[model samples]
Target: MAAPRVSVFPSPQELGPALAQLVAERAAGGGDRFSLGLSGGSLVGLLARDLPAAITGPATTGPAAPARWLLAFCDERLVPLEHPESTAGAYQTQLLPRLPGPPPRVLTPATGLPPAAAAEEYAGQLRQAFPGDDVPVFDLLVLGVGPDGHTCSLFPDHPLLQEEDKIVAALTDSPKPPPERITFTLPVLNAARSVVFVATGGSKAQILKRILEGGEEQPLPAARVRPASGELLWFLDEAAAKELNIPVEKHSVL
Candidate 1:
């Protein structure tokens, strides 16, 4: 398939509003529910800010407000919620309190399990949340690309990239610290209705160029994310888009 639409912003500040607008449109559609998969990274903080501003502003509203929005982690470190590394914990600290509601349904791995068991338990939670024909199609999945071109917990040259049987897997030897993690497999990630990769920093510029221009699927885990029936979006800051061979535009302020 051809490369998905790529949008470059001068800064993450510009990207935030666009992300908010997209989420608002999808949520307003009034599907059975709006499911979102989130990643834990610096980008998420910006997303947290943008999301509330988009939904809470003085916009015209009808009786049918968006309801039943669910949030899940695209991947998480198998640590307790209190742990500094826990993805869910980070979201709670950075994004949750800003929103108006109690909180979106957050699916987290069962605590006190061994690494492998914790991952399995989380996968089971996903299955239960999205069962049989009712498998929830994610309205939006926010992701971050690591310096090594990894997305979620899937890393460069990791065996999980080749996994096909399971929708989620446990990683015991991640190149990054806090090796133990639970991550959505390619199949599960590709099933989303929309996938947006939020990558910033000059450190990622070269890999971003390679991923977009090289065109060949390499060892980079981020390259494996291809939504089967959904739109794929890349939200890149100027530094991250510097090496890309495509023209970019600055978003006008509203």
Candidate 2:
């Protein structure tokens, strides 16, 4: 895995617009369609509040056509779309409204299905959207790391870490809540054209140190998310990166 390119911000509030700008930059690269993978957590709220500012395009050349943005989940709770914990529900209620135009296509698993069944169904949806035996590489992925260094639903010391064949896999008894879930496997996660982890808060400091400075032998799920042919970046707030030993570069949306 390559060393992550780090972007540090003084606070989560400042990090939001920078993250939004990065997405706009990726989308502006001229794709017929832009596929974005979104993970659940505080990122949901941050993007909802700040991403819209970058969406004011039509009048100016900013991003790929707003209508071409196809958002998908990296992992999701196995709950009804109406459920408060549902990631898709939260994005629909929160982020979509922040966009300047009508919502783009959103691919989500059928609610109430068994975890395994839901995973297969979601994988099928991905295959149909981006077909072929090779992994479906997303245009950009905005992710979050749990305090335990988990990304998506893949947790520490979990067998799912070695998962290679399936694009998506189901999980049960996750260390975190909403136990039953479906997640995009590492192969797909690592194949994204660009991957960024949006981490904030002092609570993330220790794990940030571990994932960024620890040896590869001691791999954390979040650290495993290295894009093979694309960019791997970490956007952190000062509180989240305090424990790191490495230097950090600052960024601007401008």
Candidate 3:
């Protein structure tokens, strides 16, 4: 297990821009396809607040093709894209306005289909976007950690957590609301070039301790998100990092 770089911020407000800057820098490292996977919750709201500031002017003018970025969800609810709860809807409404140039190609699950079928359709979309039919390695994945220790739509103790063959899978009984969702499996998520977990609030403190530290009889789903050969970063607000021995927060950009 590699040590994940931990950046503790004084507030969620400050954390967002720092995270967006880190993402922008990574995207600037030269790639025509800047693949990014987004997760929902306050992460969407936070990015909505600060990501646009990071996207304007110099960031998009660089060699990296932010305009051609491939945007997709780490997990998305099985509902119409117009629905308030829809992950795709949130990003479209909130994050899209921040981009300085042409929008990234967005890929979403066919929400009209059955859960299992939707998962397959999403997998097909990934295969079509990425050549050679191997597991898709996203250039960057921005994720959120649930208090229950879940990431994407993979809940703790869920059967989908053990999914190995499929790049995407359906969850019909998510411990969270809406019940059904389509999510990237561990194979696809772990294959990402980089992953950043943005966690805030005191509600997340306990699990952050366990994940950043160690020693659980069974690892939580969020803790299992280890990239095979890439960087993994945890951007934590003071409330979220409270239980760890990490120093008290002062705002700083990575």
Candidate 4:
């Protein structure tokens, strides 16, 4: 596995724009369609605030628009679409309208269905969206790490962590709220072209240090997120990086 690139910013204010710029750069780089996997949390606010500006700003040139992107949730709470905890709903209301063009193709789980059925249906959606690949390799996946070292709905010591066969799995015992969710398994996560973990706040400091520095026998969910042949990155603010002893690139505009 390749070592992750760590970048620390002065604060979230600085981090947000940098994150948006990185997204714009990746969107401009290659194929006709760019597939992006999104994990919700504070990341929604950050991307909602900056991504639109980054793509529409006068400084931006080329075809870096979001119109051709395919956005999928890395994990989604099985709740009503209008529910406050729904990741897909958050982006629909907060970020989608802000973009300049028509909009990206977004893949949202069928929340009205039971958890197991939702997982099966969503996996089918992924297969159709990304034909020819046994496991869809996203162009980029933007993720976040919880204070407990969890990412997506996969919590510490959870059975879902052992999942390998399913590209997406459902869990009713998530340590976090809502009790149920569907998430992309390690196979899909590890096959991504690039994975960027954005973490901020002092509350995340200790876990960040452990995830970045410690090499445990049973790695934390966040730590287990090593993309097989893809780039892994950690975008942190100083408060989140305060406890880290590893070398990190201080932020400068991308």
TM-score of each prediction = 0.91, 0.95, 0.95, 0.97
For 170-225, candidate 1 gives per-residue lDDT tens digits of: 88898888978888888888888889888887999999987766556464788788
Best model per lDDT: 4
RMSD vs true structure, all candidates = 2.4, 1.9, 1.9, 1.6
For TM-score, candidate 2 versus 4, the one ahead is: 4
Query: Which residue pairs clash within candidate 3?
Result: none
lDDT to native, each model: 0.78, 0.87, 0.86, 0.92
Which pairs, if any, clash in model 2?
Answer: none
Angstrom error of the Cα, residue 227, model 2: value is: 1.1
User: Candidate 4 at 248: error in angstroms?
Assistant: 0.7
Candidate 2, which segments miss by more than 4 Å at Cα? 57-63, 251-254
Cα distance off (Å), candidate 4, residue 236: 0.3
Candidate 4: segments with Cα more than 4 A from true spot:
57-62, 252-254
- List ranges where model 3 is wrong by over 4 Å: 246-254
For candidate 3, what is the TM-score? Answer: 0.95
